[model samples]
Target: MALAQYARLGVISRSAPGLVLARPLLAAVPRSTTTSVLRSLASSARAGRFASSRREPGMVPVGRRTRELPVNTIIKFVPQQEAWVVERMGKFDRILEPGLAFLVPVLDQVKYVQSLKEVAIEIPTQSAITQDNVTLELDGVLYYRVVDPYKASYGVENAEFSVAQLAQTTMRAEIGQMTLDRTLAERNQLNINIVESINTAAHDWGIRCLRYEIRDIHPPENVVQAMHSQVSAERSKRAQILESEGARQAAINVAEGHKQATILASEAVKTERINEALGAAEAILAHARATAQGIEKVAASISDSPNGHDAVSLTVAEKYVDAFGNLAKQGTTVIVPTDVNNVGSMVAQALAVYKNIGQARETPTALPKDSRKQAILDTLVPQQDTPPARK
Candidate 1:
């Protein structure tokens, strides 16, 4: 009776070959058309043979053509950092976010799955020629994330594989702009450049190219040997330059030291000569002053004497006799006057001459006024008459 009513309402049709039942018809098809209706119809057609497929034992079949199930069945549960793409009637409809999700079985099937977590893709190693025409083998790894699930599922066939290929192409292009030395020395810059390039081109692919790292770069063995030789030569060049600089500095320092020592020695000599001359001058001046003091005292004493002229005459005669005796004692040769008494007369004449000399240009020192000094001079003058005591 239900099948007749459904048939009368134009909900079902029959196929020609085996009277197969067709799907129920609706006045207006829904945007989210459920595809489970077809599965149910098919399941009912094969009911007896596969009734136990998804059925629990000990449960009897509720109807002859189909088994009844709850109409508003709630399907729940989603995973963390996972996105599920839903399709209605075999057409992509919507994407399911993380956490619990509802689906009308078969109709809202998960068509595409995308992980929201970061993915690391290894770019295959390949040879690239640098700007300086140096060929090198390079490999790298790329990190990316699926920012948009809808585009990730529909924009590209394989996200990891496509990103890897894009990263490789970008890396090669970036490497081609730099020399081999720059590539090796500035690896971090190279990585950033490649990542930027990949991200710029892969923006539409729902991928956020986080970072790209060049794992390794290998040059030829012959190039390695050449680099080693170049390094050694550079080191030797720097060492020679340093050594020459040190030698030059040492020579300059030695010359400066010699100049300083010579200047000091000359200064020392000049100081010594000047000090000696000062000493000699000081001695001469001191002697002159002492002599002048003595002359002043002697003149004053002479002026005070009553017999100053006679005293001076006697002193000169006595000095003459003493000198004659000293010459006879100093050497083996001796001279004797023809008349020894004549020596007294000669001394008297010499004294007269000395007294005239004293009056002419200079005054002689006066004898002391003491009686003891006068007595000695008187005795000395008398004793000089006997000039005779042999040596």
Candidate 2:
């Protein structure tokens, strides 16, 4: 029975050969009391074995480990980008850097571990009110790093949480200072302001705020709709203005073109009229020149030929008869001279007029004006015979 009890308490295994128990002590205890004690011890041993088995590998129970490091380890290897704050006898001592480090067992303990590398913290979506009284939901990301391990470990209970809260408050404050339009438009500047504000407060916590970026901003649905409408209306207004300007320019151009065309047409007409007048003048001058040349030739012929005068007299007689015939044919009534049949007399009158004109031409200043006129008239008029008593 004692041997079984010992095996049940795990002091010895039943399968082990040659296992022994103290008979005197087992005998001295009362049988009932001995069974109860063995049962309690067996239960405790089972519990301890089960708990030890359940614990994670390489992990010490809480309060038994120094800052997650294995207890009683003299040599520790610190990872890169990490800082381990050490405490010696419950007081601040020194920090352990990356790589291999030694610690006096039982005397030195790692109190806190800080990450030297940058960390990203999410700023949860929170309501913010703009200067224009518009409410917005804003969320962002914050990038930071631990600069001083000692301060990060001692200055603040939780560096990341504190920085995150500061960032949110600062973002809200900045948004409150700006109008809705500015908040939406100048997101980058808003982020920068938030980073600056966070760094200022987080300096004691040994955290440097590198940058802040707004992930999203959501305005009310009505505001979004209104903004859309405003943009559409503005675009329409610009389109109308551009169209009107284009139309006005087109009209101006058309008017200018018409004016130019009219001017050009008028100029062309003026040129045509001038050309026609010049042609007519030239024609009239040419005719006058031809007439003067013919007259000179005729004068030369009359002076050079001895029969010229007779030929002229005969030509004048033929023309005078032809003139009378033409006048009779032109109309039923004709004005005839009393001596119309006397062709010889008309020829004599014409020759006399021709002679006077020849003499005037020979000496243009020889005859006075009155004498030349009277001479031509006397030659043209025939002498009248005495008329019978007025019929």
Candidate 3:
């Protein structure tokens, strides 16, 4: 039994040269305990030798190999706004939501870990040509979130990178369709268009494009200078138009003022002429009335008084003399009456003329109209002598 135990323990085996020296130590030990211990060690050595003989190239020994457990391999605690995609036996299986989740050790693997939180991605600056042949450098930021973990994991590889590239392409296409002026003026609209386009193409990617914002736009230096010059020219044109309008309005006002002044002046002159004519007419009427009144008074006195005719004749004689005196003082040219010294004869002639006029007025209807005018003329002016008639 002792020999058999020693043989089983490898102490007596010539194949184990190193164990040959432990035979005495094995003899001192209890047979049963030593046999059990030695049997286990011998079996372990046989296993090691067999494994080494069949080991693949570069394979580490079992004792020296490291055993590390991957995260979420068995039990996992998911955080808020996070999702884990699990594949069973390398196939689609289920998703792990937030909170505690247990997974089959080797059968289930968390293939993709996606965060449900919003993410901001920056787009690198790139050159794009507008419809107006203007080249511009544009950069922007994109906001996105994963809505479905299954699609986010399997629908598209590298979701963030793909979405960012899609954003850049969409922006370029949108900018290309518009002119430089429109692109600059419609930045918000441009961003909306880009987001819409990206969302359309990435629908199956399980990513929601929340918004896109243009951070900066850089145009060529010459284009910027040209825009500045255009703005200046437009402002100057507007100013010129306003100035011309003002000048034209001022000229019109001045012409209107002059026209009004001229019309007022004409109206004043007309009014003045009308007033003067009215005054002249009134003066003539007043003089005629005073003369007629004086003549009527003189006729009434001549008819009422007994010595009226004689007094009138005497006054006429004196007036005739005063008229001659005034004519002599005025100038040297004077025609002396034939009977200038015969005052009594002149008075008699004046009285005779007054009596004739009184008779004509008393019986105006008795004489024909022609005879009456002839009689008055015959009395006032002397008749020429008749000449002999020639055969």
Instruction: Score candidate 3 by lDDT.
Output: 0.73
TM-score per candidate, chains pooled: 0.57, 0.59, 0.59
Worst 10 residues of 3 by lDDT: 60-69
- Candidate 2 RMSD computed on C-alpha atoms after optimal superposition onto the true structure: 13.6
TM-score of 1: 0.57
lDDT of each: 0.65, 0.73, 0.73
Q: What lDDT is reached at residue 106 by model 1? A: 41
Ranking by TM-score: 2, 3, 1
Off by over 4 Å in 3: 1-70, 302-391
Q: Which lDDT value does model 3 have at 170?
A: 95
Tens digit per residue, CA lDDT, model 1, 1-391? 2433533554333221111222324324342333443444344444432222343221222111222221112354556887777776668988878777787644555556677778777788998989999888989888888898888878987777788888878877998999978987999999989888988888888889899878889888988898899999999999999999999999999999999999999999999999999999999999999999998987787789988756765676678777557645854122333454565665654454345434433433443335433433343344455567778
Give the per-residue Cα lDDT of candidate 1 at 69: 26
The model with the greatest TM-score is: 2
- lDDT (0-100) at residue 35 of candidate 3? 57
> Could you tell me how far off, in angstroms, the CA of residue 237 lies in candidate 2 after the best superposition?
1.5
